[model samples]
Target: MLAIRLVTAPERPDALVLPIRPTGNAEGDGPRATLESSLPAVADELLAEAAALVPAARATGRAGEVHVHLRPGRTPGRLLLAGVGEADERGWRAAGAALARSAADETHVTVAVPGGAPAASVRGLVEGLLLASYRFRLRAADEAPTLTGVDVVVTDPAAYDEAVEAAVVTARMTRLARDLTNTPSSVKNPQWFAEQVEAAAAGEPDLHLRVRQPDELAAEGFGGILAVGGGSASGPRLVELDWRPVGARTHVVLVGKGITFDTGGISIKPRDAMKLMRKDMAGAAAVVAATLGAAALRLPVRVTTLTPLAENMVSGSAFRPGDVVRHYGGVTSETTNSDAEGRLVLADALAYAVADLKPDLLIDLATLTGANAIALGTRTGALYSENDQLAADLLAAIDAAGEAAWRMPLPADYVQYLRSDIADLYSAPTQGAGSVVAALYLREFTGDLRQRWLHVDMSAPSWAERDDAELSRGATGWGVRGLLRWLATLA
Candidate 1:
């Protein structure tokens, strides 16, 4: 984890020298000379002296590169030139990420943005840098390299404080989620996943955690979870974590699909796509991370987290497409496609959350369908919900958190798409309204609880090569911020 500290405006030391580029025809010497002229008065005549020592190349003002050199008479660090391409937010953010990545080994690094830049933009840049620089190299038994801390020096302290603080919290939560998702399946099975919930809730005075392992799930009639894991060597578990604040009027239930490793059972996935199956548990990771964030922040609402952890693997005992399974709430579903097991487990978990916990709202997240990726492309996920108001609130939350989410319809006319002639329902429809059908299947488990419910099909670019300021190339930690923002609105 990266520790972030702000350098107070009044307490900033004279030793610090920030690099800058010339605005117009002021270009004379190299980047070092230009940066020397831009230094504050507290830093002495070292800036002026350094201007005369460097070569005669002009500074480009790009966002990432840095050139620093010492002057003749100074004892402190040399003048440093930082890129500030076009003085725009995107440029600044990219530059900030590059700076963090370069300085990951340094004990303390400080970033100085010009006075006129938007505080939000600067903070966003810092946030992006911290997130992008995070590398999961824990598996190597040798030297464990980690970033200890960072100090951000902004011109206006007050305007950027709130955003910076929020970013810190978000970063911590994101890292937590990433670490869990990155853990190998052998070490992070369904039981271990349940143990993590218990451990996260151990010190919380108001939190309660419940775990239903394979035996317990079977006793509780969670056949969906049972059937999905019946063939796996590790089995399955349902984890429920509840946080209730005194006098809290609203209650929200969060359900996450935790398929630890998906080998696609009888109906196998392509070898190319199977490589990324480790991250199929991303939805579960997001919900767990969001719950932890809420507890850490002490949000004033009742929140229940339901995560069904399982591994879908191929074996002689694996459930086939023609098999019928009974889920929680007595809903029987026919397995139309064994690969569509995420929805099945989520159905059991969601049913338990709505029927037993009876929260005021329910939100289930899953990397349930590739069709969502086809519909929303790489940036945004598809959202479907029965309650428009709940959907609108979640969209607002996503917007506020700067995560992309789009509302997809749950047309009642499409309800028949999932109908099974022999069973109460089909795990997947024969036709290809894939994302919507998955949402519709979950809706059946929600019952008539009068609570607002949302289903998020996160089949979009959970991992990609083109990185953004806030999102890394892998396991975007997509729903953490959005979930936190929604909880804040409840507060």
Candidate 2:
């Protein structure tokens, strides 16, 4: 975790990061007027010197742009001009990330807060700084991160206290999600994943955790989960985390696909695709982390997180295509493609949530198909919901959280694609909109609760090929922030 705190002024900082915005001039040049006027006398001088060091053509104050000036004998040896395009929340977030990346070797740096910045911008900046600084790797002790603390220099330190605090918790939880998703499959089997979640909940007084082992899973009707895990020696488990506060008005149940490592079962993925299969459990990581965030924030709404853990590996006992498996609520799905196993495990959890928990809102997150990436690209997720209000509200929260997602239509006409002759539905359709078919198939398990349910196909967004803004290079922890933001609205 990064030590982020607000201070009245910089006290002999090793480096100074001054936020700058475009002046809207023809050349798209330097700092905004408010930034220059707000900085202290010393910082004002440093900004001028920094501007002289870098040409205006090179540093146009565009988002995530940085200009550096080295001071020979100054108390702060380095002066960085961080660009916040238009100085909005998104811009501030980009600037914050750029600052963290630029000063990766520094122990501490002072960020000059733009005067009269709103609480949203403060939160965005802090979230970006902390999130972008996240490092996850298995390395020698000598190769640890160098950057440790950030000091935000503000006029009144107490003004943005709440915003800073909230961003800290949100960023930390997102990092937790990333840590879970990035763990290698060799060490992150079904049992190990459940243990990590249990340990996380152990510290929370309001959070209750229950794990259903293989026997318990079989005793209860979780054929879908069992079918997916039959191939792996690690077996399967179902984890339930309940956070119910006194006088909560709404209950939101979150189901996540927890395939610890997906080898595509009998239908094996190519070598390239299987390399990153460790992150197939990204959805489960997100929901589990978000539920913990809700508890940390003390949100007034109740949240129950259900994660079905399994490893889809090829073996003699692996489930095959044409195999009809009965899910938790007696709904059966004929497996059409063994590779499409995420929706199978998710189906059991969703059915269980609807049948027993009866939550007011049901949302499932999964890396269900590559079609979602083909439709919306790698950065954006596809959202499908039966209720317009729920869709609108979730989209709003996603936007405010600075995440990208487009709500796709759940065409009733597309329901025909999921028809299975041998069972209630087909786990994977032979032909159609791959993501749409996947969403519609899961909707079958919801029964009459479809109206309250929303499906997020975040397969692409959950893993990043490279770092961008607040997202790291590995498991991006995509849905956690937006879900937490939506929960806060309900609270």
TM-score for each model: 0.84, 0.96
- Tens-digit lDDT track of model 1 for 1-491: 56666664423332333545445443443242244232333334644554543334345555565555543464544345565555555556556666566555555555555555566566556666667776666454755445566566655577787767666676678777777777777678888888877877798888888888788888889999888898899989988888877878889889998999888889999999788788888899888888888887778888889899999999987899989999898989999899999999998988888778888888988889889878888879888886888989999988666578899888889888878899999889878888888888888888875347888988674555565555666677778878988998998
Q: Which residue segments of model 2 deviate by more than 4 Å?
A: 27-36, 40-44, 47-58
**TM-score of decoy 1:** 0.84
> Superposing all C-alpha atoms, what RMSD in Å does each candidate have to the true structure?
4.7, 1.9
Expressed as tens digits, the lDDT of each residue in 1-491 for candidate 2 is: 77988888887577988766666663444433223346652455666766565454355677788777777797688888888887888888888898889889898888887667788888988999999998788866647678888888877778899888789888999999999999999999999999999898887788999999999999999999999999999999999999988889999999999999999988999999999999999999999999999999999999999999999999999999999999998989999999999999999999999999999999999988999999999999999998999999999998888899999988888888888888989899888799998898898889779899999999999988888888889999999999999999999
Model 2 clash pairs?
A: none
Q: For candidate 2, what is the lDDT?
A: 0.89
In angstroms, the error of model 1 at 127 is: 2.7
Worst 10 residues of 2 by lDDT: 28-37
